[model samples]
Target: MASAVSENPFGRSITTEDIVDTLGFFDSWEDRYKYIIDLGKELPAMPDELKTEDRLIRGCQSQVWLEPSEQDGYFEFQADSDAFIVKGLLGVILSAYNHKRAGEILDFDIDSYFDELDLMRHLSPTRGNGLRAMVQRIREIAGE
Candidate 1:
């Protein structure tokens, strides 16, 4: 398995509360978008070696790769995307799911979080579906 480092920070230093509060600070959607993109920049670099066909998430308009590592009960995920906004979306999702236990991942009310972020209202239909797809994929992994 590939080791995780700066490639992910969610559920560690970057909590869901942090994301929510930071997003709430912005008055304009434009600024919020920039913040989301900046979060994407924090993803570090995902190795090309790990971006395999099997790791590619299905139903995304853009190509997204997700890989998970779990030990005992804790879980962490490393994900990457071709689109900048999609990468940001991954960061938002990871903020909830990554580095959490299976139960925590499964129990997180992602819809409420997104609602709090006012995310779905600003997203395109395809982007909304893609976001749901990413969440679904992670949820399946945690279920296993």
Candidate 2:
């Protein structure tokens, strides 16, 4: 049988650098947010059956589910969220972590990346916490 990992190919081609460049191009946070939502729209839909309780991530202001798998030392991720902004946030996080080797994912300075984006400062505390939760979970999966 084909693995669950294979069933879901990461169709998003945007890279972290692409996000950074795009964010830089936007002068206002509102524009940046729009871009983010656009990015979320690019994420392929995860199968409804895969969005089970086990995949549900806690501590998010929005309902988010992430299912991960490993192949040839790289990680594959499939995620969805009830909120548009949160789904966009997932897209951002995925740009950083998806299809990366565990060491690369671990070595990445996510906080610095956020700082560069000036992202956390604009987010509500709850949303910020939720973003952190998603990052933490990805790290945990990478560390495994």
Local distance difference test, each candidate = 0.86, 0.86
Residue 48 CA displacement from its true place in model 2, Å: 0.4
lDDT score for candidate 1 against the true structure = 0.86
**Poorest 10 consecutive residues by lDDT, candidate 1:** 1-10
> How many Å off is the CA of 70 in candidate 1?
0.9
What TM-score does prediction 2 earn?
Answer: 0.90
Q: Write the per-residue lDDT of candidate 1 for residues 1-144, one digit (tens) a residue.
A: 111222323434476788888998989999999999988889868999999999999999999999999866778889999999999989899888777778788888899889889899999999999999999999999999
Instruction: Please give the distance, in angstroms, between residue 87's alpha carbon in candidate 2 and its true position after superposition.
Output: 0.3
lDDT of 2 by residue, 83-144 (tens): 99999999999888887778788888898888888899999999999999999999999998
Backbone collisions counted per model: 0, 0
